[model samples]
Target: MLVRIRGAWFVAVGVVVAVVATALLLVTRAGADTDRCTRFRDAADDRAGLVTGVGADLLVIGDSYSVGLGVGAAESWPTRLPGRVRVGGFSGSGFSRGASPCGDVSYAARAARDLPESEIVVVEGGLNDFDQPAAAVEDGFERLLARLDDRRVLVVGPAPAPERAAAVPAVDALLADLAREHGVGYLSMAEADLPYLDDGLHLTVEGHRQFGDLVAGALSTARQPGR
Candidate 1:
């Protein structure tokens, strides 16, 4: 009887230890994410301010595509864009979902905090929110648009990628619908035949140039007087 009781006690202790360890790991991860987000946010904020100081005509808030993750910043599409454009992009950010492996820096949050004033604010990105609920993504986008009420806003949907081909269409459609509902300009890259790297996600350097050209044309048309 005593031996059985001892074994039971051991099992209970093991379970408790496992539970405590798991909890500690989760807390540690959360803390690390918080730290990373703080550092990233500070740096991004400073950069945005500098861009604004240059009298930026356009401000773009997006994810790695905006940052040009694989390619260098100078080669990024945002840089290739016309005029003095400021890009506030964080890797792994989405409209609803926060930056993965980082802290809570979503599109709505960035629009509300990180970005500065500009003549045109382009809200780009939805790829990261692929698996997220549609309602959540919509809610986040609504919040972002609310904050940008005073600015000329443009909603740019995620580009078509072989990897996320299925989800990309849904996201594009949703963003397009939302932009129309909000009476803002919307750009859908769903059928874009852009080149991608091996990852089949981000655009290649050439692809970025093509994308930049496309956007420049759109902006030019929008700039024309009257409807």
Candidate 2:
């Protein structure tokens, strides 16, 4: 009968539509996974470059916080840093070995070997050293600065943790003294108005932009004809 024929046609059309829809869903999911995998691989490759010795004008050294995990390389503050800045920080790296379960390489040693003779050097690590004594952090920092000689240094202070911000003042003071002794400038994340912290720690996309602006301003001032 005509009714039976029409019913079969409708069922066939519905099946075709369902198959197409399922295929689209799978394709979309696969694309997303591929993108994530690509980002991971890119980050890993960048780290390898650092370990193998790639020098740059402005070397940024730090840990995961500096690595800008979950954020693109261009969105990282170091990459965004103006006036010839380059990335040297590896994800999960710290100032001293055993500082973090993920960190083994010494940031200072990496900088000494990999950084070129540049006017500016930005060092952004210390949170991992918080559990350790202040003296240890200071000593490690001192060694790093000594290697830089007279190159302008900007020691980036840690972000504001709900509880850790209280200790930042003391830490900032110590960092300031160190900078003065070495004739280097220091910049603190606490001083910058960070409305873009992803989780009270890492800078969000907007935060990275703002932080980059601050770094540029500092570099400009330091490199001014007079001061």
Q: Per-residue CA lDDT of candidate 2, range 119-162, in tens? A: 67677766556565667666677667667766666777666644
| Consecutive 10-residue window with the lowest summed lDDT within model 2 | 218-227
Give the top-scoring candidate (lDDT).
Answer: 1
Q: What does candidate 1's lDDT look like per residue over 1-227, in tens digits?
A: 99999999999999999999999999998898788777656655544543422444888888877777676566667776666788888877888854255655788786777556677877778888888888989888888877787777767788988899999988899988878777788888889899999999988999888887777666632221111
Instruction: State how far residue 167 of model 2 sits from its true place (Å).
Output: 3.6
Residue 159 CA displacement from its true place in model 2, Å? 2.3
What TM-scores do the predictions have?
Answer: 0.80, 0.65
Error of 1 at 77 (Å): 1.1
Candidate lDDT scores, in order, read: 0.76, 0.62
Candidate 2 deviant stretches above 4 angstroms: 1-56, 94-98, 196-198, 220-227
Error (Å) of candidate 2 at residue 211 is 1.2
Q: List the residue pairs that clash in candidate 2.
A: none
What's the lDDT of the predicted structure labeled candidate 2?
0.62
